[model samples]
Target: MVEAVHTAVAGRVRYRVAGLKRAPELKKLLEFRLSRTPDVTHVSASDLTGTLLVCFNSGNTVEGLAGRIAAIVEEYRSHGGGLAPGDNPGKEAGWLDTVPGLTPAYEAIKGLFALGGEQPREPWHTLTPEEVLARFGTSPDTGLSAGRAREHLTTYGANLLPESQPRSSWEIFFGQFQSLPVALLGAAAGLSLLTGGVVDALLIAGVVVANAFIGYKTESEAEKTIRSLQTQVRPTALVIRDGRMSEISAAEVTLGDLVVLRPGTYVPADARVVAAHHLSVDESALTGESLAVTKTEQPLVGVDLPLGDRRNMAFLGTTVVRGRGSGVVVATGLRTAFGGISTQVREVGETKTPLQGRLDSFSRVIALAVLGVTALVVLLGLLAGEAPRTGSEYARRFTWARAAEL
Candidate 1:
């Protein structure tokens, strides 16, 4: 298995594998294998570092992407074939291949990546209240007709955060063992077990298991907290549909639907203020400022104001602490600022901690020291008349003998 090297904000993933480095033939074989995978936009392998970077559509999950690469690596290790018939490997190089530089250039290209291609965005904040209403195919006097609302809902899907796919408990538990320190410990335990120091091996494995339990428990709690916060967002919304006001589930709210907001209401989507009566929102959920921010319907003059200063917009997850106002929903779900942040959190790659880095270095040093000691012990044992066990084996056997005597 290869380690995930990097992942860009736009869904490009890089994997670093030492086995394929300097092996041009193998690299080409891998590139060919990956090219056939579905949803993979591009594949590139660097001969210098044996790094394979793949770009996929936004819909692809990281786990699925990594599994695909692992499968390809396994295939190369097995049959080890060249490019299949009629497979011109050179044809797969995307525009990214012609570009200079590596990670940075790929990131720039991915930042502009769009799902289903980009759609033009209307500057609703620049328009007047009446103008905004007209553009949405609705009016101030009457909201979207029932039939129109249904069509919008079908187009936009539900206004809700996509639930994360649940990982099996065994997978989560096993993932903890991937750390460098754990790997070293596992090797030590294996060596101990081979020498018959069962107690010592059990103790080392116990530490590993304890560490995994702590990590798993902490992650489970954090997930529960996030779910609680999501539930706090208003579950139901009051919207004017079919020329009449009705209470509906927040998920039923659609674009161009005229939403009704008042004190104690949580905005269901990112919206532009159309009408307000001293509208003030407690945006602390987003801005972290306890004070309520006042909002106005008058077109904001400046384009570059912080979320708190925007004054004429209401974001999802923020509560209407005071006054009353109505805004046309502009963005919802993952399109909202809150939703974008959530997406980033999910896609964000794990960074090595300072201690983890030191541990990695320590692991290398330990590996070298162990190899040297093992070689020296083997040489001395061979020089002696009777064959002797290796250093670790000798230690384990001595411990077992002593325990039996006790």
Candidate 2:
């Protein structure tokens, strides 16, 4: 049983769980659960230590991750799942619903973190180039045939990002009104108009419009950062097709396609390096680290690897700065590492910082309190046979007098 810790260093933490070293099923459950969390990047159990280690994004706290682990432990116990190795833990597989909306496998996140310890040992990165080619049924020397390429194109779709379609100007403009406060203000405006407060309604409506417009303008400015990714693609790439070297638009590059890499070239899709002659690349576009990374056709070991350490793989939107190498396109489109960043940036509104979430909760509480107090005051006024009083000048003077009395 892992005791819950209130604090931990950001990004990485470890918990000691009894019998987990010998209980493979329990270990898998812990790894699968943590791997599904949006902020958690890596999870592994050390059979030697009876400990579960996790690495996550810096945006989340260690306390939250530890709580999740503790919750899993409690839920497993309450459901009569085994905590000891002799408890026949495999029978507890059906109890995974304790964590809402989580899938049993971690394959969805396998692509993003696979470059280093960010991902577990998936097939492509762990396999040699020849082995990868055999699995894809493509030739390392001739690449995919034109007919097979067409079939894979149908299977994988285009080599373009799907989740990150540019927000239209109108979408950006209208999306600004989708927040809770904005909805409440819109309701207030409607109520003001219905009550024959046209001037007051217009003033409130004007404020809403002005606020939305200012937001739209500010977002339009920020939209430029998303456009920067558009510039990262090289537009065209050289590939080996039909046993002959040819140049094609990067978008047409698909799964099983053998993309030739050289100096000053951009990788159009995520690929495994089959051959390399001193290959190095500028991966700053995806990782934000400017150091040029060397490429190789070697498999890396250890659960502590990061994306930057995945030297055997070449990711999309990264530039080849030195030497030459070729990688089999294992993943395409939004499945690439670069596409993962695009997806993250696109859905950032849903992944609120912890402080932002707390502030939003506090705002709702304050709003409800204000509404309840106003309703009580109106009830008291009506019962006393008096009208509900208003006027900011009276409110200000009355508040001061009450404060002095207190």
- How good is model 2 by TM-score? 0.48
Q: Write the per-residue lDDT of candidate 2 for residues 149-192, one digit (tens) a residue.
A: 76666555667665445688999999877765666566665665
Expressed as tens digits, the lDDT of each residue in 305-396 for candidate 1 is 66777777889889998899888887767777788888997898557799978877876676556556656665687788545546566655
Whole-model lDDT per candidate: 0.68, 0.68
- The collision pairs in model 2 are 113-119, 117-305
- Runs with alpha carbons beyond 4 Å of true place in candidate 2: 1-122, 137-140, 165-204, 207-234, 298-306, 338-406
Estimate TM-scores for all models: 0.55, 0.48
**Quick one: RMSD of model 2?**
21.7
Worst 10 residues of 2 by lDDT: 112-121
